[model samples]
Target: MSAEKWTPDHLQSAENRSLHLEQRRMQLLPVVDDLRRLAREMAAVVKEIDGIEGDIPGQAWMRARHVTKPLFKAADDIEQAIGDLGAFNTRYQRSYEELPQKRAEKRRRKALAKSGQPEAIESAPAGSGSPKKDEFEDVFDGLRQGA
Candidate 1:
């Protein structure tokens, strides 16, 4: 019997599914970015209100109240958006993980037909170099020494 050959259709299906998930992930990224920006703006507004409280005596109280309401509302919206982004991220991660598995399965099927033996799994080897330190650690260490 002739050796069975793997077809393009299986690979194409996996590629299509991966592309679809990627598209969904891309769509959510902009919304997440916008929410993050809004959150930062709200934080800035809170700081501005705090600064104004010390400068302006009577009117600052009323203005702070008004500013706080909207800031809280914006914060709420940011929280919801962050939750949505987290869910989207989970789905994106799952799709990303599946894509590699599908590709590996296709390769295994081809190998089984050609070699008539179980396919061997390959993985990246561990690093040989020393571990790297985070950038913030150096700055914090300097601050601690100065203090």
Candidate 2:
């Protein structure tokens, strides 16, 4: 079911999922921060290596540039994963604390039903005549008699 229509059990499950995602986000933060630092370091190293020799495309320059691509991409991917986990946590965190109360209310009703208690009828059963029949019954009779 959609998150908006979640049952209490589903809410608890969603809350657990968010908690797990939050944990994953926490674990990934340090790694991603490290990767960002490393990417910055790679940029500095690339600039340094590029300037070492004048206008000569050496093996060091080529290797450095090639390695930088994957490192930067890895950093980008980690950043994206962190963002996703954060969004998931934000979406489901409230549900974690709200479900138990809802579930209890649901259980109370279920228990009441299992006890065979008669539920109050808000409206009369179908095909049953109106309860105020006598109040209206003389109106038409009076009109006809006056005519």
Candidate 3:
């Protein structure tokens, strides 16, 4: 089932999943910060290595440059990863905050369905009927409304 589809029967599981997302986001935040710091440190080291002078042999300097090339690239990759992780964490946090409203909305919809009321469809925006979401989509599915 889609993660956001939290009916009354699966409310506990929904809450647990939301808590898990919060925990995972918290855990990743530190790692992202560490990676960002490490990347900056690595870049500084690379800069220091590139600035070395002291009669170093031509071949040795070339090898040093070669090794530092990958170090720079690694730092860049780490920065990209940190950005992606931070963005994901932001999204997770938003989803966690919105879970209660989503749960209430789902419950309301289910109650309407059970009562065979047409207000459910009428209450929804015109041409905005809910569509099935992919299981692997981001947690913001609840807010997307099939967009």
Candidate 4:
């Protein structure tokens, strides 16, 4: 039923990989937090610029206005980095979560095969014992049945 064969060693390896990925994902949180802090600082800078504009004369502000655009651009860059990190973290978490499930499924299928039961039959309910079928046949039947 599973895509790959499983052994104890295979399951252990998958578990280890999952743990490693989870650890790496956890490590990313601090970096993301730091990026958030940086973004907040940038926002403060923008607010300061706003305050400066309100207090200073137009011509004088205009003379020093070049700094504001660059500050805003830096903020945008930090925000983009945070977005990218979030995306990476999501993907990492998904892969980590799926790895253990995949390994368990593989083990179940292998055990079924070893016990002389069809992997497909093992995957289905106990009462569904309509002879053993190959994966393709099972899939085709499901499609035909609109399941």
Model 1 segments more than 4 A misplaced: 1-12, 51-147
**Against the hidden true structure, what lDDT does model 2 obtain?**
0.67
- lDDT-better candidate, 1 vs 3: 3
Give the per-residue lDDT of model 1 (tens digit) for 68-117: 56645664665566566456546655676677887887777667657655
Q: Report the Cα lDDT for residue 121, model 4.
A: 64
How many steric clashes between backbone atoms does each model show? 0, 0, 0, 0
TM-score of each: 0.30, 0.42, 0.37, 0.32
94-119 per-residue lDDT for model 3 (tens digits): 67667778888878877897899987
Per-residue CA lDDT of model 2 for 37-104, tens digit only, reads 89879877786764445556576667677778787789789879878766755656555556776777
Best by TM-score: 2
lDDT-superior candidate, 1 or 2: 2
lDDT of 3 at 131: 59
In the order shown, what is each candidate's alpha-carbon RMSD?
15.9, 15.2, 15.3, 13.0
Best candidate, lDDT-wise?
Answer: 2
Model 4 agreement with the true structure over 19-131: per-residue lDDT tens digits: 44455456555665675576567555655654443455564445345545565456466556656655654665467667788778878877887788866465854675456
State each model's CA lDDT, in order. 0.57, 0.67, 0.61, 0.57
Clashing pairs in 4: none
Relative to the true structure, candidate 3 has a C-alpha RMSD (angstroms) of 15.3
Better of 1 and 3 by TM-score: 3
Clashing pairs in 2: none
**Candidate 1 residue pairs that clash:** none
